[model samples]
Target: MSYDLVIRNGIVVDGTGARRYRADVAVADGKVADIGKVTEGARRTIDADGLVVAPGFVDPHTHYDAQICWDGAVTPSSWHGVTSVVMGNCGVGIAPCRPAAREIAMRDLVSVEGIPFDVLNKGITWDWETFPQFMDAAAARRPSLNLAFIAPLTPFRHYVMGEASMERAADAEETAKIAALIAEAVDVGALGFSSTTLNQHMGFEGKPLACRNASREELKAYANVLKARGKGAIEIALTRQVGVLEEDQCELLDFLLDESGRPVTFIALFDRDDIPEAVRNTLRLAAPMIAKGARPQTSPLPLTREVNMDNPFSFAAFPSWKRVFADTSKAAQKAVYADPAFRNQFREDLKNPTGFSNWGRVVVHAVRNPALKHLEDKSIAQIGQEQGKDGVDAFLDTVLADNLDCELTMASWNTREDRMRELLNNKAILMALGDGGAHVDMLCDSGYPTYLLGTWVREKEAITLEEGVRKLTSDPADLFGLKDRGRLAKGAPADIAIFDPARIGSNNHGERRYDLPGGAKRIVMPSRGVEYTLVNGAVTWEQGRLTEAKAGKVLRG
Candidate 1:
């Protein structure tokens, strides 16, 4: 029998947590035709000799809704062997927006996701307004990787409530209509709905995100829609402050699980340096909910970011930052930074022992001022000590001197290898929260799949290769119920990744690229040793480069 493509002489991990075996995988008609000896002639053949051929990595959390409009290839993630991604995470997206509310959508993304407003302005085509129409538009783009979407609650609330969605809880009539929209979105293609309670998720005009205003009754109603359907999952950005989860938050998790019989995946569980026992405590509190199909996602990558005060996304959690967000103009921001009142409040906020409090870990990344270049690698605490000022004062003064053009880097939690190993080994915790397609300039953690393999599996020996592949593949696919994906078998979709285990990983830092719309710059994390990536039997990425094959499908739940 003939085949469309044949991958020869490779070790197959199969993404099932099974033992690895050497096999020849053959594809035909966009499905795996055979996995044994493939002697038949094929139109294309890839010599994956000495490489590990596994199911393509699936990134379950991303914000590619805007980027997908322009970049059909969905780089960095695609470059790192990710064949599928779930977008519209954390209840922020651009669909179901009225023409009049277009600017509102873009501005919300700018504040919450750190995407440049001008970039979104130049990129999104906005050919559709309704949820199903949005799905159709995404499918029409013919992306290079499989794309699945969750109905973000913000836009539907905005569509129904207009300006008041951010101000108060929806009335009975508004709640019914909002629920109807979520149900409509699910009926078409949405996996389920996503909403956020994170205070850091500020939106247009420094207001808390519209979804944050959802009352418990409103959320219970939305969850019931899925309960009745019995075929969806919910992703929520819980009110988890760094590592702190209040009792009410725990009760909320239980309520959502009771309301929605379907699976519920929460945003993140990270190790915190300030509160050393936070991860363990949260896990203990979550143990009951987890037993009831509540999956808490965590990242293999550390929480490190290149912070520029231009957006100040890393500081959104600080109440003192509201002064900066209230007025985004360069002059206003400089004035706020120099204000003694603002500095005192910021310093007081810094004493709260969150991720942002570690001024010693914050270093000056880059500076445009040639005279201040000597301070480029110095820590904020070091500079504070040298100048006999507080760290917050030193940090802001440096930014003020540079006119907010300086770049500082803050490396926070999840760096402890011992803690990460314990987290990665937990079966109840799903591996995710990559935050790809968001934080465009601040970070690029989309290359985490390779990082898991290279650093965790190969180097640290935290987990076996099979377990690592399974975490990146079937675990996430199962979370979203993506059919016939995340595994290698006869009749399964031919989404595959082939790479050298010895050389698979990304660099410690990302390289900046002026590739966004309107010539905006974004940090791009590139991968090494990803030899080939195939989507639906098509070679989309071969030998460190992307091919022109648009084989992606807009996946429906």
Candidate 2:
């Protein structure tokens, strides 16, 4: 028999939480046509030799909305066996905007997701204004991997209300216009709608994100389309500290889920050492809700963000720190640390008790000032003790000494083994929330699938290989309703990642690469042991290089 492609002699972890077995996977016309002993000669054959072949991971959360227009493979994500990705996440994206509103939409993406504003301006073609048109653009791009998107609330608000999007609640007419957009979006194959209440997402003017101004009434107005259609999901970021939720946040969360009548996933429920009660609070709130049919989202792999001192707006998570940095020049922003009164207020905010939760573990990597070289690779807590100061003062002083170019990096902090196991083992909590492609300068969680398998399954023994594969593949695929892509069974789409189980993790600290349009830099880390990645039975990447393959589809539900 003849086939389009074939993989011979590999261990198949079929991504269904089943026992692994030795099999040969054959592909014909982009679907897994056969398994077991495949004696047929194929047009292309991959000798897996001694690797594990699993379904390519379906990333249910990412923000590759704008990047896909310029860099189609979606990079580092496709490099890590992420054959399918759901973008336009976190309520911030570029679409459904008129030409006059384009600048603010671009600014919203730049400010909220860290894509450079110049890069966005030069990179995006702005060929489309509406959600369907945006999807068509991606489809026309014919990226090497499958892509889907959620209609974000931020752009919808911007498209309708413009600058006033943040000034007031939506009036009835605006609500109806927004709902019509949402209906058109889902009707044209968007995965769902995404909104965020996270305070950290600021606009270019440093005000709360436009989505923050979205009233629950308007959201329901839009979400009712998803409910009425009996499809799509809701992605949101709620107000919380680790596991703990404010009373109103919980009410709104339950309201969003109940009213939508579709799966609702909230952003980033983490387990923090500083807030031991945090994870418990979240589980308590979600448990009863999950029992009654609500799905919360979590990431099994921890996150690392490489932030520099000059523009370390990450500290704005602290209220007082945010107030201090409000609308300042770089010099003025740095001066806020020098002012004793502002310093006092900033320190007071450090008592957020739950703030950051991992600053003590932050290591000062490289500093722009040669004089501060001695602090390299030392933890902030250690540097603080040596300087006879607290972590806050030590950090601020170091930033000042380096003239704010210090690479004060936050390494992977939240994924404690026990905590991750608890979250991953929870069937209801989908294994997602990797802010891939969006936080490019600070994070590179796009390599999360390989990290989960190589580290958690192989190195740490926190979970079985089958379990990790299931969580990475079928769990997220089922969550987002991509039934065709997540299993290595016959008749399934031939999206697969082949790797040696022992050597499949990326480096602990990724190096920066200036690959974005306009030579803007982003944190890019390549993974190890992803020997071959096939999208729709076509080899897109192999042996550390990308192939000229574009067989990916823009999947619609």
Candidate 3:
């Protein structure tokens, strides 16, 4: 029997944490038909003579809900061989929204996810009103990679409790409504439920996000719906440290795991010398829960942020910055930079935490400033010494003069290589947290997959290549119950990547020009040595270019 396609002469790592073998894989009707010695006639053939064939990476954490609306390919992530992605993370999603709540929800997303509000306003079609409707809309659109979604708790709270969702505990009626919405969402194919209880998450109005105010009881009720359904997990973003008068964050995890009897994953677990004891304490608490059948995992990498001060979304965490910049019209923003009084206030604010969060003591790593273009590698402090101005003042002045569009490099939180290696080696922790579709200007961590292979495995030998592949592919698929994909077995979906293991590396980290709908600017990073990427038996990408094959589907489990 003839096959539709064949990938020939490659070393196959079957995503089972097993050794690799040289083999040929044949595909027919979008599934792998044979794993070796495929000599049959085929419509297309790819000569992967010097490549490693493995399951396409499964990115279990992303915020691609908005990006997928316009970009079916989900760029950067697609460019990195992520065949399956789970979006609507951090309890922020765009569905189950009323027409009146559309703008408000968009505002929350813009502030919380660092997406430009104008981009959301101009780009999203708002074709769906309910969670099921959103899923169906996504299915109809059909992205280049298979996509899954979670029932975001913020919009559900807004849908049921209106303004009260952002202020206080929900009433009994509201609780019931939220639970019902979650049930409906799961039945309609949402993979799980997600919410954020971190203080860092705020709406566009500078108030705590809607999910932050939800009571423990309300959250437990939401989890109960998933418990009854027995099909979805829970993704949460909780502060590592809980203050007085609030439920300890671990208690919430315990409740969700106990009540739902399902998997509970949290946003981050970082490594800091000052917080070494805290990390140990967290692991101690999680041990018993896992022993009792709860699935708890933290993001394997440390949490980091990339800030671009020119964007309103850049100041999302700083109420003062929001107040200063949110209502300023584009023309007015340009004018404020020229005003001396406004510039001084901005300079003064830069010294404070609010301003630091927005525009930190970052160095001018890459600059378009004509005055400072020669000092691209110098820090603002270094440049300030030459100009005889305070570092803060110099940064503000240069940024203001550059119309706030200049890119500055700040030191990130996750710099400890040893801790990163420890996290990667942990059996329980899943090495994901590539916020691919959000924070358009600040970061392009979509290259994490390639970075893992090249830096951690090949170059540094921090982890074995087989272990890296397992974490990127099979582990996430098993965690999320994606059955048909994530393995290169004979019967699995033919979502595969062929790359040179010896030469695989991430492309340079920088910004590229990709015009989204409504002319929105998005930062993207392409990968090197990724010879070919196949999605569902079709060659979707080959030799750094996209093919005509559009065989991706909206995957639901």
Candidate 4:
């Protein structure tokens, strides 16, 4: 029988942690029909002579909920050979929203995820009002790559409790209704539900996100929904300090594992320079929990971001910084930055020491006023020392001079290569949390799949190519129970990535793209060495360009 497509003469990794071998892959009817000696012709053929054929990377963490309403291809992630992505992470999404609460949801994404509000206002189609409808609407879009969803808890809580969701824990009646919504979503197709308690995850009006207000009883009720179904996983953003899991955070993980009886993947386990031993300590603490399916997500890339003064997301963890979000107007922000009292408070807040307090690592990336061009690329600490001023004062003064149009570089933690290797190689640790569709303006970590393949597997040799492929593929697929995906074998769905391993990686910095709705600016990292990407047997991305095919499907649990 003839096949639909044939990939000839390539090194096949197959994505099961197996050794590579030269083979041919054949696809038919959107599934892999054969994996060896495909001599018969097909509708299309790709000569992948020097490429590594592997299962398309599965990104288990993202915030493409709103972006999907506009950009069906999912951009940079698609460019990097990722055939599938799981969005609605951090419990911040644009679903289960009422018509009146539309602005509230958009503002929550703006505050929590660094997406521009105007972009959301112009882009969101708002075709659905419930979780299942949202899933159906996403499917109807027919994106270029496969899309899976997690029912974000914030929108559900907000739907049931309205404005009160952000203020207090839900009452029993409210909790029951929210749980019912989640249950209905899971029954239809949601991989699971996600929520967050990170202090940095402030929502509308700078309040702790709606999920942060959840009491233990309320959370248990939500988890019981998954426990009863026995078919979904839980993703959460825990409140940890300086990359170290505090006692309370550890207890929360244990509690979730006990309550859910399923996999509980938490956001972010990064290395911290201020607390150098934080990673090791957290890994040691997490060893026992690993057996109980507690996976902490980390990234292979360092934490570098371009933070604009208008949206200083890197500093949102500080209590003093909340005032910046209180009034978003340019004039109001300029006044706040110029206030001596505000500067003093910020200085005092730095003494407590979170990640962004390291002025030495913060540099002046760009300036609107050419007169201040000399300040570009100088660390805030260095500039402060040169001017004989405090670092906070120097930093704020520089931005104030530019009328808050200055962009600063935040190169915070996760720089230690030794610590990163340990995290990547750890079986319990999943190399994810790419945060692709969110933070569009701040950074584009969606290029992480290529970064992992090019850096860790090829250059550093931290893990073998086989293990790297498995981590990016089956591990995440199994975590979310994505059936018939994350492998390049007969009978599996033909979502694949073909790339030259020798040259696969993304640049450290992203260039600005004016492609968002209303031509809003966002940083995008162009990939290197990804030759082609296929979603369900269709070549969606070929040689750095997206094809016309929208072969994507809304993947459900």
Candidate 5:
């Protein structure tokens, strides 16, 4: 029998923590038809002779909700070897919103996630109002990679409670309505539901995000939606790390787990020097829960981003951040920065000490203007001293001179070497945290999969190639219950990546592009080693360029 496509003579890493082998794979009608060396004729043949063919990477966390509206391929993500992505991960998305709440939702995405308002406003059609309608609108489009979604709790809260969502806890009737909405969303197609209880995630009017105010009773009631379904997962950005959970937080988590009876994965366990106890303490919290048979996991991300004076999200702690993103165009932002009163206010705010990344540590990354070419690689403090100005003036002046286009990169703050090695090797951690489609200009983490393989496996030897591949591929797929897509076996969906093991990695943050709609720019870290990426038995990318194949489907629960 003839097949549609064939990948010949490749080292096969089947995305299992097993031995690697050599094989030829045949694809037909968007599924893996057969494997092992074959002379069978085919419609298309990829000569992947020396490459390592493995299951395509599945990014368990992303925020591509708005970007998917305009960018079907979801660039920077598809640019890497990622074939599947889960969006609406951090409890922020644009559905189940009333018409009056449309502006609120768009601005909320801008403030919380760092998506440029122009990109969100101009690119998104805002076509759907309900969760299922949003799903239908998404499925109608042909994305280049398989996409799944989780019902975001923030919007659901806003939908039912309106202006009072954050002021107080949902009343019993409102809680019931919210639970019903979540259950309906799961029933329609959402994989599960996600929420955040972090104080830092401010929503409308500079308060902690709406979900942060959700009562324990509200969370347990909502999580029961998953219990009713008998399948689904829980994603939470916890109030504190699992190890540092207070009695109230622990009770809430335990209640959710006992009532839902589903996998519970919380956000983040950073291997930080200041928080030396975070890693071990988190594991300590998980041990008893696991013994009692609970699926509790945490994953850290390698988050690096480019910053500029015009980007409001980077230095949001700065008092004038809202004023920075107050306008859409570069000229308008320049006008805001140029105002003497605003500049004085910014100077006052800068004089106060801030603990985040220091401006003295930021280096002038690139200079687009010919006159400013000599300023490249100089620290912002140095530039400030050279210009006889203070830190804020020096940084903002440089950006103003360049029309708010100057990019600055910070010191690689997190991800200590010893810390990443331990975290990557922890089989129980379920490696994740690629905030791909959000924070377009500030951060791009879609390249995490290739970075893990290239840096950890090939160069550092923190983990073996087999284990790294498994972490990137089948591990996440299994955790999310994505059937027949993560492993390279007969009858699985033919989503695969073929790359040179030695060269498969992500480029540095220095690279960027302006391909988003309406000429809005985004930070893009393109992958280096991936040669071919296929989705559903069709070639989507080859040799660092996308082919015109929209073979991906909207995966539903």
Candidate 6:
């Protein structure tokens, strides 16, 4: 019998934490038909000698909701061997929105996620309003990678309670409506629900995030739908508030676990030297919850920042910058940054070390300023020493010179090596949270899969190659309930990657590209050693080049 495709003579990892073996895998009708020595004839064959063939990587967190409308391949992620992705994380998606609220929703994404407004405006068709309609539209496009979605709480809350959802707890009626909408979305194939309470997420108008003010009661109401359905997980991003509020976060996780009887994954668990014990304490607290049968996971990577002065989202922590950059035109932003009076006001605000501004560590990263371009690799402090100017003054001058287009990357203060190792080895933590399609200008974390393999497995030898592949592939699939993919098993979908483990590495250094629609620029990092990526029995990417085969599908719960 003839097969649709076959991959032969490769070291198969299988993504099950199993030892590697040399074998051949055959696919028919988009599912794995056989695995072993397949001498049978096939329509197509991939010679995988000297390469490690494993299950395709599953990215559990991404914000490709708007990008998928026009870009089926979801580049950069696809480039790094991610054959499947879960979008609409952090409670910011582009469905279930009123026609008037479309721009409003886009504004939140632009401010909080760093997607350009012009890109969204020109790229998305704005044809669908409800969750199912959006799903169907995405499916009809036939993307190059499988896509799943979650019912974003911010849009649901905003749709039900209007602008009040941005700052206040929803009333009883609004809560009930939100619950119903969530249930409907799940029924129509939304994988689950997600919300964010981090201080970093703000609206375009510089207000609190839409989901930040959600009451416990309201969130519980939303979780009840998942409980009734007997499936789906709850994704949350909350800060560590001590005392009574500490109990609140734990209680929320408990309630969701109890109510949904399913997994609950938190956004991030970072390592901070100042708060040396925070990561340990949080994990220690979560250990018992997991022992009692809960799923508590955190982002595998540290919380890294990419800052661009031209992007409003870069200064999302600063209220003044958010308000100033909200204007769509670059001319308006240039006018504001160039004005001497406005510069004085910004400097004064920078002097005040409020929660809204992070001025001290704002190093100059990228600059079109001819005077500053030579200082690219130098930190603000280093530049200050060379120029005999204050670091803040040098930063401000660069920003003004570039008219706020000067990009800067301020490393997160949390860089404890010990804590990173502990968190990386945690049994309860799932390795994920690569915000791929969003934050285009400021970040390019889509290369996390390659980085994990290269950094942890090869260079550092922190984890074995087998274990690292398991985290990138099977672990996420099992948690998210993708039955037909994620493992190199018979009858599973033949979404696979071929890479040289020794040479796999990430090249993300906060570079900009003008590849998006409307000439909108964003950050991207191309990976090395990913030789071939197959999706649904088709070769979609090979050797850093994409094929025209659009074998991807819209995945459902």
Give the poorly placed runs of model 3, Cα more than 4 Å off.
Answer: 240-247, 272-281, 290-361, 380-406
- TM-scores for the candidates: 0.93, 0.94, 0.86, 0.92, 0.86, 0.87
Worst 10 residues of 6 by lDDT: 238-247
Top candidate by lDDT: 1
lDDT of 2 by residue, 432-470 (tens): 776777878777777778887887788888889999999
Extract clashing residue pairs from model 4: none
Best-matching candidate per TM-score? 2
lDDT of 2 at 127: 88
Choose 4 or 5, whichever is better by TM-score.
4
Residue range 1-557, candidate 4, lDDT tens digits: 78999999989998889899999999999999999899899998999999999999999999889989899999878999899999988888988999999999999999888898999999999999888889999999999989999989999999999999999999999999999999999999899999988887889998888988999999999999999999899999885574778778888999989999989998778888777788888877877777899999888887778987766767877888889889889988888888999888988887775875578888888898989999998999999999999888898889888888988878777778888888888888888878887888888778888888888889999999999999999999999999688988899999999999889988666889999999998998899999999899999988989999999999989
Give the winner by lDDT: 1 or 6. Answer: 1
lDDT of 6 by residue, 409-527 (tens): 76553345556667677767778768888878767778889988887788877777888888888888777778777899998888999998878878535467898998887888788
Q: What is the C-alpha lDDT profile of model 1 across 407-465, one tens digit per residue?
A: 98888878788999999999998888778878888788888898888889999999999
Clashing pairs in 1: none
Better of 4 and 6 by lDDT: 4
Q: What is the C-alpha lDDT profile of model 5 across 23-80, one tens digit per residue?
A: 9999999999998977899998988878999999888889999989988898788977
Give the C-alpha miss distance for residue 527 in model 5, angstroms: 1.1
Clashes of each: 0, 2, 0, 0, 0, 0
What's the lDDT for residue 178 in model 5? 95
lDDT of the structure predicted as candidate 6: 0.78
